[model samples]
Target: MKQSPATPLPSPKERRRLREAGSLTQAQVAERVGVTREMVRAWESGRTNPRGRKREVYAKLLGTLAEEEEPRRPEVTEPQETLVEPAPPAPPLTPAQAFDALYAFCAPALVRQAYLLTGRRELARESVERAFQLAWQRWPEVAVDRDPAGWVRATAYEYALSPWHRFRPRYRHPEAPPADASDRALMAVLLRLPTPQRRTLVLYDGVGLDLPETAAETEASTPAAAGRLMNAREAIAARLPELSDPAELHRRLTELAATERLRAAKPPVVRTGSERRARFWTRAAIAFTVALIGTTALTVRTAPTHYEPPIAPGAEIQGVPERVAQGPLSEAEVDLREKLRGEMTSGPVRLTPLSR
Candidate 1:
């Protein structure tokens, strides 16, 4: 049977109901259609007829509305295959390459979460950067872990909790920091809690990390980690009045993530020669300081020298000359000297004393 062309269109009340149910508001539809709320209101009320751009926007909105209004039909099942085809082999990844991949993938979400946790742009940036740097260093060990993002979040939280973050001079600027509403709201609540509690809450609830993974990242036992998360949640829940609506908060977070992704995708700026030279000198200085420290440590740890006892004095030595008789000698002494001389001239010398 041939289906007749779809009816002209549903009424504005019907369209509004669909839009509301599908998580869209009149303001959102207006922004998408580039129209004013009053115009949308009028169109919905059937007081003002929409045409051209307005008509086009209405048509698009109605179509979207209709699609959302349709019931979720059950998915059709296909015949079972006797044998499943194996997935294509993945290319092997080097540690550095894998680190870069994971960093790039998680950076947006991490940054957004950091901003939400700290409410400070600079802190968020620093936290994210340090987390990625640490991740890079331990990539070989961490890559095999089940939740790398959780690890990154935990690292970032530690970075946020570092003394520098708490003690650093605050920036005083005319313009307020630009963060989404959700980030602002979340950060306000997070900063009120102690650092450890805040970190636990952000990792588990904000970033969706499991308790064991959170514990591993935070260096806490699983039960302790769970307690922290629960405590954080309760604290936030107590201060719920300060936060915006949950739905609005979610939307703001989504927007922040999108913005970060767009910003990260842009080409990085190239450093000038002077900048490169400065960085090289800084690295060289660090290396020299480390070397000097190592040398000093080695010198301090060496054992001191001590003297040993000298060899005992001997009564007689084989290699020494015997005292010789002086002046004119008796016949016996002369005979002994002659014998000694004869012995010395031969292999070895032997002396005999004469009786008085």
Candidate 2:
């Protein structure tokens, strides 16, 4: 059974950020969520809040924000080391060269992000590598993008969260939590939060995303995202008060996460740019051929034909002649016939017994 978020509503600031991240106006958000524009404004201004299904609808209206804000960079989530690391010195490089440089720069961080979302080492590597493969496949598009790293990061996270990866053979049975009592307790508490709350907490604190970005990823209104984070943090704090600070909580998770040491995963399936186009054309050609053949067969089956009756070699029948009757028999012929008839019809003549 699914659990509902407990004990908090999102903040107005979170709500506003969600609206902006989604590129939706107050009116549009209000209409979709079954409220007035003023009500939406009130929510954003921290004056009021929707609850229950309406709140969920508001959250869902922001669902496609990730796709909408493609060019914007996600808030910096780099570790202190990655932040201090210097970029390669200025040098002219080909498209492949630049992207390779990019891959080396971003791969480690991206993998870590995936790991937080997936909670498995191999799955994380697979998610990040798959995302990079896609980046390579669309290098031309990635090349011109203002934030290629962000694009890849977004893609990696998308894959990591996919239900497909969860169903992989290795994941069919979830691994037991760490043996440490604290880690086990933390994991148990995190699991108890609603799915959205857990994901929101991870994205905001674990992944170091700002509110708007977290809202975008979680498909929640900014306020809703904030509310989720608040609820999650409060819930965790209730169990472990010393680590009430979100940062401390995240740092502890990192320690538990760092202990996982699985081998690298195989690369995800990625087709070349041309291969995608070729696959589409092949399917289209097959469909057209099948439709043409079906049409031809139907036409032939239903076509009208002129049919001629077949005649047997000797089956002719003769026609009958018209009848011709004499008007009446002549009187002498009639008398003769009558006399013969009387003679035939008469009984034996009686001769009176003598003249007695």
Candidate 3:
């Protein structure tokens, strides 16, 4: 049977055993084969068989095949498919839509800040609402700023201090309502400070703004802002003797601030397209009426009129008389006398002279 190819040389395990008996590590064999130790282990364990240049190196390292034997080459193949394309992204919202979103996001915070500043619930709501209205009008400008919430809060504070608010018939002094022990205590401390001091402290410490930002928002100098903050702290400290530990008090105050911020946040009531259109029409109608009145006034001013004055029933007509003169009276008289003498009897010269 031609010796049956000698049983394929009893596999690589027998060779690995032979090499191990010589006190060499798998890493040393791997270096000789230009492969990892794990690869060598797999080869020795019969989990894989070396191919290509690796097979040649392995055979040489194990003294099984001659160095002159050429290495076998691995087959190459192409992929059957390609990667899938991704879907397109969604479009961005318009300014009005974005305003609606931002208003919803910041309303509560605004309300809370207003409440803290004024210490009255209704005033706080009014101030916050007015701020949101302003924000809606200037959304294109306000939305581009880095901190929209800060802008809204600053606007709400300004609204709270507006002359309209000051002069409104419904204006009421801000007063803290009855609350639980912790809230009552907090309110008492807050109430003791001046409005500016309280507002500064709340903006800086409670709302987490830095000194410069707080000063800018409050329209005060850095030193003035700092003084207000200090005064507020001192006032609160004096009122709350129980808050002896500054760190603990700060922690509690931060928690209270978080609570206040959450409470103030509320969903905004948005005006629909129809409602906005209605408002536009209403304003247009008023403007049209005013324009009509103005036009009528101008027409009356420029138009001509036929007006006649009244005459008295009886009135004398004043004028001059025509002139008349006597003709050749003297000559006529002389001639008449001569002729009468000549003809004394000439009928008495017809002294009937010319008919007068």
Q: What is the C-alpha local distance difference test score of each model?
A: 0.65, 0.72, 0.68
* C-alpha lDDT of residue 2 in model 1: 100
Please report the candidate that would top lDDT against the real structure: 2
Ranking by lDDT: 2, 3, 1
TM-score list, all predictions:
0.45, 0.49, 0.52
Tens digit per residue, CA lDDT, model 1, 1-356? 99554335468677677777778877787788887654565566543456665676678778877786788988869866689889999999876567667777777677777766666666676677766666655666789876686677778866766765445457333224445665455556667888778667655555544566567777899999988877776776677654334334344445644454322221111112224555777899999999999999888788456667789887765777778877888999989988887774556556899999
lDDT of 3 by residue, 1-356 (tens): 57332223237667677567656787788777787665666566554576776776666666643222336757759764878889889899987678778777677666766766666677877777767766766677888886787788888888775656656666745455535578667866775677788789777666656576778878999999999988777777777766655445555566554454334333345334324655887899999999999999999998778766678699776785757777655988989988778864635343455766
lDDT of 3 at 262: 39
Model 1 alpha-carbon drift over 4 Å, by segment: 1-91, 94-96, 137-147, 170-186, 241-356
Tell me the lDDT of candidate 1. 0.65
Clashing residue pairs in candidate 3 are 108-264, 108-265, 343-346
Candidate 2: minimum summed lDDT over ten consecutive residues — where?
262-271
Candidate 3 scores a C-alpha RMSD against the true structure in Å of 27.2
Spell out the clash pairs found in candidate 1. Answer: none
RMSD of each: 20.1, 19.5, 27.2
Error of 1 at 12 (Å): 43
Error of 3 at 188 (Å): 3.3
Could you give candidate 2's per-residue lDDT for residues 1-356 as a string of tens digits? Answer: 99888435456687688678777897788778887665676567553466788877766655455456568767877655545668889888976678667777677666766665666667778777778777877888988986687688878877877877556688887666667887777777876777678778777676556677678766779999999999999999998896797658878767655655433332223334335755787899999999999999999998878776779589666886768877888999999998888784657777877574
lDDT of 3 at 110: 66
